[model samples]
Target chain A: MIGVNSSPPLPIDYLYNFAKELFIHSGYVYFPLLFDPDVEKELKASGLCSRQHVEIENSSSNILLRDRESWFVKGMSLESFVSSYEKLAPESYNQHLEALYKELPFLSSIDDNPITDKLCTIILEILPYFVSKNRRHERKKLTRDEVLELVSEKLNIPPVLPEHARRILNIEKLRVALNSLSKARPTCSKLPSGIVSKTEFEHWFSESLKAEIIKNERRKIKRSIASREKFARINEKVLAVLFFAAEKGSLEIEGFGFFATEHEGEFIIYKRTGEYALKDYYGRIYMFPDCRVAIRTNGTLDPFVIENYKHPFLQKHAPGQKICMRNTLLPSTFTAQNAIFAIQEGISALLYGYKYRKRNGYHSLDSIPMPGSTVTFDDYMVPKDHPRILRGEVLVTNEFR
Target chain B: MNLLDKIKKAREKGKASIGVNSLNTVIAIIEAYSLDSNFLRFLDASPYLIVERKNTGSRFTRKPDLRIPIFPLTSRRNYLLAKQVIEAIGNPYIRFSRAPEEVYLSKFLYRENPSISHDELRNYHFEILLRREIDKKKSKNRFQ
Candidate 1:
């Protein structure tokens, strides 16, 4: 449900690449990249600052930057980009900007000849540390005309003649087939429009415009979807096997495994419970409490701890506290298969990813005065079929949620 | 000043009339801005504009973009205010450079307590929004 997916994180790799390239090209010492309202909190928290509508790329998120700068970079890893920026001397920052004073590379005009399928068939790719990041409800606003414009551009045909709307798509002679309504076209206004993203935007595209494009265009979209399918598929299959055992009070994957599945609104949520071992970066492990993983089928929304468990990494504040899915990137359209893998990652991250010394997250689980240890999950001996879970068959919706 | 503060001080300051219903809309507008980026923090809610649909009378009333509850801030006032707000927000990583009436919500701060009459701003020509803040340190560096 847009209800659950709500406000997802922005494109980290895209922004990082955009930021690094901007830093290299802009002669100005500082510049803000205005984003859509959706990404405002996320970008601001990352220390990237700046300042919409379907009436093209309108949204609170789209208005993030109030400047002129390029945002497309072919390839650059986030870590390498950030590390390099960190290594740059203060003098180098200015000198670097000055180098572009005469020939601004970042400001070079772009060839907007439909940046669709042309870019890459190769690849695709947020943090939890920033608490209170703007995670608002999805403001999906899209129109038929805009979708038609994009389709027209991609198909490379003269503008559709008003006299022959159906004939154009029905021509059947065109090599590049675009997604079109079979018969009765839905009214544009009733059809929502909002994502200025190829992402959340893409999900919108896939769902709203489910027509098959040429292999070239679909390759890029398909590659992203396929990779995620691969990542989450393995997790789902593996967990199902392990969970089969866990249901009988035996083997549990990682610390715990899935036991039951239930329906919640539009989502099919799989539940995982057990004593999870969270090992900080220091190698010492802490048993986390109330470890309940309730992964909903909706791809965009991360897993939630059904027990209302709030940890540094798992805090979405949705129906149940949603997991942040830190570093775990999902394409705009999260498929059903991705949930289990995401659950696996959520539980695994809690297992060995924590850094005891730094307490690396937006909030700390430890109480004030440095309890010196994380919250304990000592009930490893608890049966996977403990009555607390089995008896509470139905999910009690969190009212404060 | 925030919207509430401005509405309170409107009569004392002899400011333009901000209708009662407009306050709700204006508050909604400011909330939109705050949910956005650092715009609200740098901006005060002084640009609360009341858009009443007037009859196309003796004069040709150009349709203001305000037909919808919200639209892009591409007017000159929008540009100037965005520049001022960006500077005031003092973000070390970003600097904004927008055009005149070309784009998003870089709202207007109609804090002109007395000068511009309501009639003067009662058309498409005027770009009124609801947010304003000035960081002296950053603005000084920018304007200097």
Candidate 2:
């Protein structure tokens, strides 16, 4: 009787875990795979581990001597490892995997096998079939060379033999393919037990072409979101708030408290009970009331004018007015550097982004109205001698600097 | 001229990111993607990444997740290079996600494995992985 949970440890399973830890520590996944001489031969023969001589882009390009150590390089990818491990790794390698598997201790146990059959090893698992949907049942058994050609075309993975065509009359895969085309699962046309339609060889080859495409797309989006998530952790958030505060030098995220979590978009939530003075280039100063700012991880300020005031650029003319960033540009990918620029830019816009004379955006800072628009709220205007002017730049004397 | 040296220099110059002084952390990322074999896995694996428990990552709450920040403790000026390096690494897990970002002693590796101290694994297991990845990054066919 078979044990319920006793499947043999697959090489893929062992390598998967190792690759994860590697990716976490480093952004990349890799391995050192130069323990045996036959590895190169088996890899070349089996069409797994498909990395080639990459001439290191050093200033001195003529260093061919050192360049010769290409195969002995440190890292092998999961795909390359997966491709190679099926042949090079021991079946028991999975059992040997630990939170710590070393080179000599575990990796060295992999005894290499000389290449016997090239295409059969990684075909179904590593290399998905490139068969088109309409061509599922076009005819009888395809020759071995035909199958190899199909696999090669799928990923431009060069054939192992590198020949015109390998002409085996009866490869086991094609035999199965033939059996799929003709016989019903319960032995033949005269089958007894199983349903005929449930078993089709088409699922093996035809369906995977579609599956691989979808998998690739999902992989792209998932990977972007996943790695991107790493940039905005608690460690980074604390640093960002501190850096922004240091750079601004006056404002503090810790005015009340800082709340950074996924729900609130990793924010530096702060409330200040005093007024801030905002000035434009044309010597126009506006006194703003007590402000509360929520700096998001994306480097955007929310409810920017939390004390409720109105200007043309404000989304609304009431409390919790969000500033419009229609005139600014920010980075696409999220990182701390990008965050700095975003926060700085956001602040800069609030501080000196308006032209009182031109009345460029929603409303001019001065009393000048747009061609057909009216100016509201002369109440917040402050004279030059106001005591609570936190931020505003005005030209005082030409020779002061 | 050396990759590690380059990374170190970048890190030093990039001290503006604050508290990201760990060379190994940055090296792990760059080294993993430097190999073509590993780089290609990004294309193959969907969500090939580590979830840092439930609520730890920089913007785990929302990454659909564009509105966030990470000060680059290293590779500061070359933010785009950092991006490319990240893209190149791709997720290698393929059909799998949700693996532990940092792997510790697996139960299968040793019988009564809890008997051994974390120090032993730190000295032997992890060090070996890091060294191998480093060696690979320093290889002739590096980043192929």
Per-model TM-score on C-alpha atoms: 0.23, 0.26
User: Best by DockQ, which number?
Assistant: 1
lDDT of each: 0.34, 0.36
- The lowest-lDDT stretch of 10 consecutive residues in candidate 1 chain A is A121-130
Instruction: List where candidate 1 sits over 4 angstroms from the true fold.
Output: A1-265, A271-273, A279-285, A310-319, A362-401, B1-144
For residues A81-159, could you state the per-residue lDDT of candidate 2 as single tens digits? 3334324443333332321124223222322211111111122211122222224587655543454345344424433
Candidate 1 local lDDT, A62-127, one digit each (tens) = 323333332222223322332343132333333433443234332122111111110111001011
Candidate 1 local Cα displacement, residue A292, angstroms: 2.6
Candidate 1: Cα lDDT at A364: 46
Q: Residues B1-144, candidate 2, lDDT per residue (tens digit)?
A: 999999999988876533322222223343343432333344333221222232244432221101112232222112223344335433221111111122211211232232444454333432233334335546846666
- Work out candidate 1's RMSD over C-alphas: 26.2
Which portions of model 2 miss their true places by more than 4 Å?
A: A1-274, A279-284, A290-295, A298-309, A318-322, A371-375, A387-401, B1-144
List each model's interface RMSD. Answer: 7.1, 14.4
